[model samples]
Target: MDALSKSDPMLVVYTKMDGRLEEIGRTEVILNSLEPLWITKAMINYQFEIVQPLVFRIYDVDTKYHNTPLKTLNLAQQDFLGEAFCNLSEIVTKFNHSLTLNLRNGSGHALQGTVTVHAEETASSRMAVDMQFHCLNLDNKDTFSKSDPFLRVSRLSESAVAIPICKTEVIKNNLNPVWRPITLTSQQYSSKDDPLLVECFDFDASGNHELIGSLQTTIAQLENLYNSKAGANFYSHKGQKKLKGQLFLDKFQEKVQHTFLDYISSGFELNFMVAVDFTASNGDPRVPQSLHYIDPSGRPNSYQQAILGVSEVLQFYDNDRRFPAWGFGAKIPRGSVSHCFNLNASTNDCEVVGVEGIMSAYSSTLYSVSLAGPTLFGPVISKAAEIASHSVQYGNNKYFVLLIITVCNIYPHVTSVQKFYPSIVVCRMELSPTSKKQKILL
Candidate 1:
């Protein structure tokens, strides 16, 4: 039982009599001490001569206990974890309860404490010391109101504990190894110009650190998706394009939902995947009508525009800065004779690969390749479905998105089949940070 345990105090004393400290049963220990000295700032000091070690015939507990904490240290704790172990005094404090230590003159000497402790990992036993000596008796405790204590130590209240940061990565979107540093209005400690540390409790950098990495960017898409949908909805409510309270509410909800700051505090992983459509019936490659068109001015077609816009915002702002782009309704780039349907899914690739490659190829194809007819939405979509269905195999963090790009021509002569469409499965992708998959549309 550690100092934080709330075990039975009587059991602790009983163990002392049994001379079987090692046989101490697991339980919690609660420290209930507040010197009258604390009130007058009478400079109440304590000296720890020897805290009674766990003596046990059959050790039980001291008093009330709660569920063992899942984990006690946070990531930043890694910096000095070994150091903490090397100097037991660091974890030991003036107010400790793991052992029923005898007070040196009973809580009014130079602060010091002792309790036998066992290492969970090593099982190595040693006397753990919690000391706070050398503190001046601030007879000025009341007078010290204006002066800050060089060192003030106490167990934190429930509300004072820091929240932990968590992450979720999309299969295709999280493809970056590095994150850009964010500028802080007020950088503190040794963290100025430093890369953001993910789980540090300092309110300042905890937020900035998560947003710069690859995960925050993927979350941004989810934000934009929410916003765009809402913006569109609010526009519909007014029966015209205009801002309204509902739109403002949407923005408020979005800020709360996706900002990496709040998510980290609440322990959330925000990752998502995006898949695009590519197929024939988009239009003849030679014509200016294709959704993947490269206009004479070199501007990309609208399909590329919508997808790229979303991708740009996400990649820049999310924790994962990469996305996998894919194409269907066409053969693998090198396949001879436009092979109708050989699912061309590459492990994760950047959106730039598809954007630049597709534009370049679309231009070249316009000049050198012939546009043939055969619209196949099913095969392309099915490929996306195959990837989406793998959530079970890949585990929970993975998700796939199929964003089909098309415009229908409602001519009565057209067939009623869903497969027959101006629509195309323009792109396919995996949206997890762990997945090394991408589909190039060239």
Candidate 2:
């Protein structure tokens, strides 16, 4: 009993936000062990330019007084078993890729054990793992009824223990239960060759679960079984009784996606363009009900907010910060509903300095142009596509972002975008009648 009475330890991670620590993620509890090695990994986004402060809190879960979801004590009221703080940059640079950080108590005294950090590149793409299982003849543990069965999959750690990654929902009153599919990340699933331990259990409401059986296999073996459609049958013993089961890998595929870092490292820059609607359906700009009305309280409407939110993040990539702002569905000062007319009202100077410049041009055009209808977006889209194509011809690493504030189908614009495939983004905003919120479609 003394060997089974040890504490269950767990780890919690936090990131600094606006001078305060906010919990971002945590590890699973390693139950009933003195020297537990958690196979669960913690992930954090790495930005080269910013100072990202991270905190790791360790605690011994008192199963007798489980309060937190991770079944651990509260950090503020109850002291963490120990805490450690470090900047993300220091982990990679100061530690030469890995370091052992000392954990300290609230009084700043060093704790017993050390937490190891082995920094690695964040995966460029996330891979989803799908798993399923079926029991052949599960052992019945319940006296009055059939046993409730469920499956739990855990990866075998380098530290000689299995750490659970995912679990299936319990199916009540069944001896041959086919459990539902479980999903996990590539990191959580670990490597295809790593030993994955699957265990079947007869679940109980009183917190004491009976183990029906267990099996040891790798993802590679499961995939082979799935492809052959003849899953392997295995057996285990519990006290003098024998248990049997079959496990299957439903589906497993990895999709790779390129991020901004991929393009940025290749000298790619984002070129921004804005197209605003001047249709009569917007109502009179002077009216408070109008979607285009500049609020009397100095708040921006949907269009202005969308443009700012996107452009602010993109401005860092654009070297010159020059944006071309245009208007459609309106009679410009030139007396034409020119879909590609410059909102700046200049024939030769279509480009604006920055996001503020785009706002100025849009506001100024409101006073000069008369709102007209029969909304069409193909022309502006085509014009932006033409500019993007020219940049491609010149071998410049330029990506186009087109912001369209209108309510109409632009099927031809979709075709135009597919023609060049020039890394284009179309952000559309429309106000919903039933809801006070504005809807955005990408």
Candidate 3:
């Protein structure tokens, strides 16, 4: 394809799902380079239980389609430069989290090239830096008024590509603006010594934004600016022209927050609590259309599936495996409508033995309790919060997970539910009958 110049190579990554190839991401075309090291990353959710096959194909992009966006470019028109195949787990499980695969032609014949795939866990680190920034003097890009300045911070990759990490709010008609403090995580900046592109742009109603100035600095340099009480001068896109603008760091604070994995590894337990919706909107339990209807074919209903899906994952984190289960918006036998009644029908105890105990309790409750109206989550949330607060008061290293399964649109007492115990993680699963889709909101 490139007769005069070296190949302008671009890499396309795809995941094989159910024998169909689904494009995940594409790398930018590296012009006039045979061995191009692409900086663009294709992120895929790695599942431990399943094998995720990945296909990497290279293409020689023609000069005519150089201006076209990589996403919109027709790959069929580009010259094929062979492909490589490997499972995502292969790269992740390696010593350095990298694997090299020899490229092969369409006929599975070996080619004269190899592609190296590297995997980095983005959420492994919880370290973050919060910094407050204020501009001193910015270049006036507007003709009628002062420039509406805003800052955009981008981390420069190994290939010098600007990957945006964070941005500040636009301060209208102001050359000197003090934006709110922004936090950048370790995953965003990669390292303190890595170069970061801080660009100040003049806000415009039109899509075309005028660049006031840009400067390349690192997190370390920003910290130094804060310590020395000095400002960094901004320069033009090409470093040839120096602008009369400067960026001052008001404050720089770096904090190391512990991740969920850290807590689990440190003997912290995640206790599970479940609250099921028994509102009339879910239909009758005897009817097949009901959300709580037990299937005779041994297939799980939406409610059962939701409970099993969440409980199974959390059960391993909990040492005791005793889950507090409750039912809301239903009238129990010989009682008025109870918002937060124990699923096991116990007056004193609400905790069940295990996931099986929860299922048995839920099934028995359906037969004994009658579905009532006006879905309320306040009582159930209050009960879950009470348990969580008790655990905290006892100095227990426990995190409560409250799973609420519902088929309704919204909770009436959502505000109260939101203001519940801070230590409790509320996961609301809403199952739609029309679409047969389940949406889990945290």
lDDT of each: 0.29, 0.74, 0.87
Identify the runs in model 3 with alpha carbons over 4 angstroms from their true place: 1-124, 158-160, 176-180, 205-208, 220-231, 238-240, 250-254, 262-268, 331-338, 368-374, 392-397, 420-425
* Ten residues in sequence with the least summed lDDT for candidate 1: 36-45
Best by TM-score: 3
On a 0 to 100 scale, what is the lDDT of residue 401 in model 3? 84
Root-mean-square deviation per candidate: 27.9, 14.7, 12.3
Better of 2 and 3 by lDDT: 3
* TM-score attained by model 3: 0.64
Cα deviation of 101, candidate 3, in Å: 33
Error of 2 at 400 (Å): 1.8
lDDT of 3 by residue, 1-442 (tens): 5888899999999999999999999999999999999999998886643567899999999999999998999999999999999877556545566789999998999999999998875653678999999988898898898999899999998999999989999999998999999999988998889999999999888867899999999999999999999988999987779888899999899998765445544667778999999988888777788787888898888889888878866665567789999999998899999889999999999999888999999989988988996887878888888888898999998888899999865544444555666788788899876665898887
lDDT per residue, candidate 2, 241-324, as tens digits?
Answer: 334555555554445445545555456677888888888877777877676778879899766776676666555556688998
Candidate 2 global TM-score: 0.52
lDDT digits (tens) for residues 423-442 of candidate 1? 22233222211221223330
- Candidate 3 CA-lDDT value: 0.87
Candidate 1 ranges with C-alpha deviation above 4 Å: 1-280, 289-292, 316-322, 331-370, 408-442
Summed over model 3, clashes come to 0
Angstrom error of the Cα, residue 194, model 3: value is 3.4
TM-score of structure candidate 1: 0.28
